[model samples]
Target: MAGTIQQIAELAGVSRGTVDRALNNRGRINPEVAKKIEQIADEIGYVPKHRKKADDTVKQAGRGKRIGVVTQLSQSSFMLQVNKGIRDASKKLADQGIEVLVKENASVDEAEQMQAITELEEEGIDALAVMPVDCDNVRVKLNELTEEKNIPVVTFNSDIVGTKRYCFVGLNNWQSGQTAAGLMGLMMRGKGKVLVITGYFSNSAGSRRVDGFVEELKKNFPEMDLVGVQSSFDHTDEVEKIIVNAMSAFPDLEGIFVASGGQAGVKKAFDKLDLHKRPYVIIYDLTPKNEKALLEGTVDFLIDQEGYDQGYRALSILSDMLRRGRTPEKEYMYTEINIKTKYNLN
Candidate 1:
């Protein structure tokens, strides 16, 4: 026997009205309670007629809506491309009566991100797109905004796991890490010392990349020595000391995989070493500094996880969701990961 809305409401300790509102995704109900009711419905296999009607209601009322995009946008050229993507999307959607408000933080600060989201919520944004930092507090805040405020969120660049974000727009970071490991192994002939420089450990993307790279090396290139891993926080100035220390400790270091920013500083450190055989350097992104390094033979390869597509598509997806109550067919829309070398610099 198929369960009714009454059954769902009773199981969730809510009223029939609440169950109807939640399952249909209509009306202003507590997001937690709504989530509970929906879960109960799914468990009991209860379907609502209002599902079709809700979409129509949203489509009719959703035009001329405003959206907010919050990101940890720094002065880095990579972030600049992402911002350009957002602006491009905004321009494309202007005729459709959709408005995008982009807000950026200068650094990867979770507190600042939370505050930005809070301000956007207060502004009554129809939806939100965020470059989330993987933190418990940020996830909680995101949940609160989604369930409590009924604003759908899509994460770009970085992700906050175990939350209700509609979807993630980025690369297959783990696979990308494995890709880098493969390149490192080939460049160093599967032997010699390697140093890994990572961004914020709290960033899900960076952590996943590191995990994949390390796991790949452990499985395939057991002979390769992983000399050390240092956190640079993706800042250029902070990376010099870490790189200098590694070079001092492992004078025979044959390669480096910078999983974040600060590649420019790493180059400076190499200049100081002046080794007859420079280490095989592999880094991420197509930033200007990285481009110069690749051309000059300072970096062997670059793993480019397209930033522009992430920013552009995140907003597009969020806008569709806001206007038509449409959910993405897939949970993660992964961008392409291109391996750029000097030969392909053109």
Candidate 2:
């Protein structure tokens, strides 16, 4: 343990010059000598110029602090926008000597989302920004990891209530739902029947959206009727079939409001049933499919929640809490409920 340079060379059976060169990067050495020096250093736990050396090694690795982003944006335009925000934020942070690493997934399920989080943990990341799959079990597991691992976790878009999280960044879901219903009532002139398509109702965001929409519709639009409600499970096939049935049952189904990125399938069902020709459709999240639907007069309006802003802000807060040790504020960020008509769609 108290080996001098001479002792190291003697024990390594190499000249002092070779050992010095290998350790200090002063001169060229053969692979065999380099391997021997490395082995002896590891065995003896040699303390080299480690402080400066470690700093320089980390510096050479990249800019400043590194944070991991785990997201589920598979194919939704909403999630894609979130990714864009992360990229722009990462680039800007790099200018300030911080690096952002992102791993984007669009799988909106608990098992897959957990796997993504697990992988990020294994990567030895300093902090995390995630849009966790909103499930009770998944949330409990994430909270456990955050507290135990000392890894800062921020939730975007949906609420992971009652946790030791850095912060929750996204809109008031109830308000967003109310806004959608208000839009639908106005577009339909507060008359005729409508069908509501919901995402996973268990997720608070999805449930709150439905509650807000229903409450507002009941409060303001007395003449408007919520004819049927369908739980789409956030799947295309189910959405399509249910919409077809609802449209047939309510031929005068003047309104259709889908609660999430379930528009792709709903749009298809409407087109197949020629429901677009009869009803006013309000879609959530403007994926390319939904954008086209808006353009083709199939989807009347798309609810725009700045998912990109949510993703970026989540990272920004997580980074600050990590690097500067700042306490995070709730500062609930609401996605702007934009109605994408033809003019705006273009």
Residue-level lDDT of model 2, residues 251-272, one tens digit each, is: 8788888887567786678678
Q: Which candidate is the best by lDDT?
A: 1
lDDT of candidate 1 over 77-167, digit per residue (tens): 6787788778866764453456788778877788888889888878778888998878888999889878987888899888878899988
Task: Name the top TM-score candidate.
Answer: 1
What TM-score would every model get versus the actual structure?
A: 0.81, 0.74
Native-to-model Cα distance after best TM-score fit, residue 64 in candidate 2, in Å: 5.3
Off by over 4 Å in 1: 1-63
lDDT of 1: 0.81
**Stretches > 4 Å off in candidate 2:** 1-57, 60-64, 95-101, 275-277
